[model samples]
Target chain A: MKLKEEIINKLQARGVELSDIAEVAYHLQKPYSKDLKLEDCLVAVKHVLEKREVQYTVLTGIALDILVEEEKVEGALAKIIREDEPLYGVDESLALAIANIYGSVGFTSFGYLDKDKMGIMKELDTTKEQVNTFLDDLVAGVASAASAKIAHQNKNKELDEAEIS
Target chain B: MKLKEEIINKLQARGVELSDIAEVAYHLQKPYSKDLKLEDCLVAVKHVLEKREVQYTVLTGIALDILVEEEKVEGALAKIIREDEPLYGVDESLALAIANIYGSVGFTSFGYLDKDKMGIMKELDTTKEQVNTFLDDLVAGVASAASAKIAHQNKNKELDEAEIS
Candidate 1:
């Protein structure tokens, strides 16, 4: 399958609902523009997912989770990857690293989502399901990137896609 | 002096100009609004400077720089903080941590500034007069935070200073 589809499928397996993620997109975009719809948020997020950085982060996060679960990586690193020790933020940093592709705004968004535990994020944190130490911020990065993309695109009424680069 | 001025003063001591930092702010907000003024960017940055997180980062970046300059912090960390070692991103993480206060938008702004090396950022990168190992991303964080602050404020005409919380 395509990278974006694989990324989404991995997230879905971990319980991240696209609609709920779109809700996050809506929250971010609604503050700036009233015309933004949930669909717009989804479109923006999908576009952000295409960025190589975003794809790398998705795969990295998933791989890290698997490594931790199988006890393949351990010791100090395992403690951080598995338990997500509050002070040892390697996981959060790694997840935010993906978000970093979009910008500092993703830092803020990831910080907020990590703090607020909103929507599906709350579920992903403590389900009897798979370990998702990275899912929360990973999703936050996606939504934040999507939000930035939408804002950038809407900046000009007549500016063509070429201008965005 | 007031907290904002104090933060600026601290950054200034590190060789970052208020004008140069404001240039970073302007680059971030200009795309969103044609009405953005340098003074507006300054005001927004000043407000961001008020945050305890931002204050802490300003001081921390300075401290790290001093540590590097004096050869006070060595080992792997010193390599990362002192030279901003290409892949050793601990320093960048410190800067982005400050940007986290604003939102994902700040991440986007920081990423852009880091990538583009525009305006004062270009100058800050190499002015043999001072050691600026951590200066680049720190400046980006400041600019990005300032940018996010402006965007958050402009989202609603009626959003009072009281509502910023």
Candidate 2:
């Protein structure tokens, strides 16, 4: 498997979503990786996922599940799940959740990606329209998550080096 | 037509997904509004759908559209549009995208609803598995979007009142 996919699978196996993994992958791919490690990235992802600031993704997910159980929205989410709606609309939220892990800077980066559709998404050229908006959010979530992750990693790394001294 | 159905048809007519409307409905009924007017709710719904914060949903939807066009995620999101798959995993990014709108609070609420499976989602029991994780993300997106919608409405109302003054 490709490195990105490998990372994605590893995270997913740990209960992280593909989008979150992709967000981390994208962030790690930047020059920042020169100063970070895989463990750092893992911690960053964990921090954002559990942080209070960006918990809306988890909250919304729960609510949607409830709606589905109640057979609300013509069982729309259920229908989407049951019939597997071809052009699903949930990708944007997934992407944003990852980005929100970082911070507002992540939001800025997300805006750029959504407008640009850089990398793999642009190549897809699918009729699905929410790509820019949702991807922007996803990128932001990833960035936010990474920001916290990076900070935590730096703190721990510094402490570790000090201890080694 | 039932209130929920009416909302669903309106969303479908506008090319919005049933889940999207269902999500809006979820917020429309809860803490956000004790006696929410359909028209007012519609306004809030449109606000979120049109707001840049909610763009993540749009972007994910578009990606799934592309994936469906290319035949990826065969049993999940891609199939939902084609009306073929029995169950489709929602694109992870989409859910996150929506959650980012309301920050982490909304995302957490989504998770709670998904895990509990209360309200409209109860109808989905016979049709599919519990889908706690996926639903959590979806609910986060919806709630975040709804929060943004509510925020926008409050802002607009404030602006209108200010103008009258």
Candidate 3:
């Protein structure tokens, strides 16, 4: 399978539906856009998944989670990751790369989702059986990037309309 | 030449010195680490440069700046970039990718430097004769990533010392 497909499959296996993430994006952007559709948010999510940085981040985060689960990760670092240690910021750091592609609005939106723990993020965070240290943040990253993409599109649309007027 | 060497050369041609960036890194990290040396900051800056994401960001940003200067970019987008419009968040977005590799602290540090516009950032921002919309943020990104790297190292060192005790 292609990298994007593989990432999608991996996310699916983790019980995260793209639609759920899209809903988060829709929630974030609906306040700013009156005519926004859920389908538009879903499209934005798909675009975020297509990015090379997002693919790499999802792959890397999932691989690390697996390593922690398999008891392959060694020593102090492993414990930190396994516990989802609050100060161990590497997971969020990786997720930020995904949001960073969208711009400042995307970056801040990721921060919001990360803190608020909305939608799939809440489920991912509360599930103690699995090491979701990275997955939760990655979901937020995708949602925020999609939201930011929509915001940029909306801005452009306004500009075009203004020009026409 | 290697991609890294080419990037360095490109940066040099644009009047950005690695040492100057390292100094920014040193200043950011010094408050947190009493024993930190400028050389250590330089080493961290070098390591940040070695990242594929950072390298790609620097290359892409510089290429866009060149495109803008050459008048190859079209229409409203060109005007936005040429003027370094405050709301043109794409440059900072690209820069954030560089800092995201380090972790949350590095990411926040990049935000700080970006807002404050210290050191070479000031030079790059104010020299209006040339287009440096992206270069300023790129430099800040490099410095912040290096600072975050040192912070991580310091944390590990503290852990080690505690274990030894």
Q: Rank the candidates by DockQ, best first.
A: 3, 2, 1
- Candidate 1: which stretches are off by over 4 Å? A158-165, B1-165
Q: Write the per-residue lDDT of candidate 2 for residues B20-112, one digit (tens) a residue.
A: 445555553556555555456455555555544444344334333433444443222223344422223343355655655655555555555
Better of 1 and 2 by TM-score: 1
> How large a fraction of the reference contact set does each model reproduce?
0.02, 0.19, 0.19
A14-43 per-residue lDDT for model 3 (tens digits)? 888899899999988898899999999999
Candidate 3 docking category?
A: incorrect
Q: Is candidate 2 or candidate 3 better by TM-score?
A: 3
The candidates, ranked best first by lDDT, are 3, 1, 2
> Clash number for every model?
14, 105, 0
- Model 1 residue A149 CA deviation (Å) reads 1.0
i-RMSD per candidate, Å:
11.3, 12.4, 4.7
Q: Which pairs clash in model 3? A: none
The global Cα lDDT (0 to 1) of model 2 is 0.46
After superposition, which runs of candidate 2 have C-alpha atoms over 4 Å from their true positions?
Answer: A1-157, B1-35, B51-93, B99-105, B128-140, B151-165
In model 2, state the lDDT of residue A57: 41
Enumerate the candidates' DockQ scores in order.
0.04, 0.12, 0.13
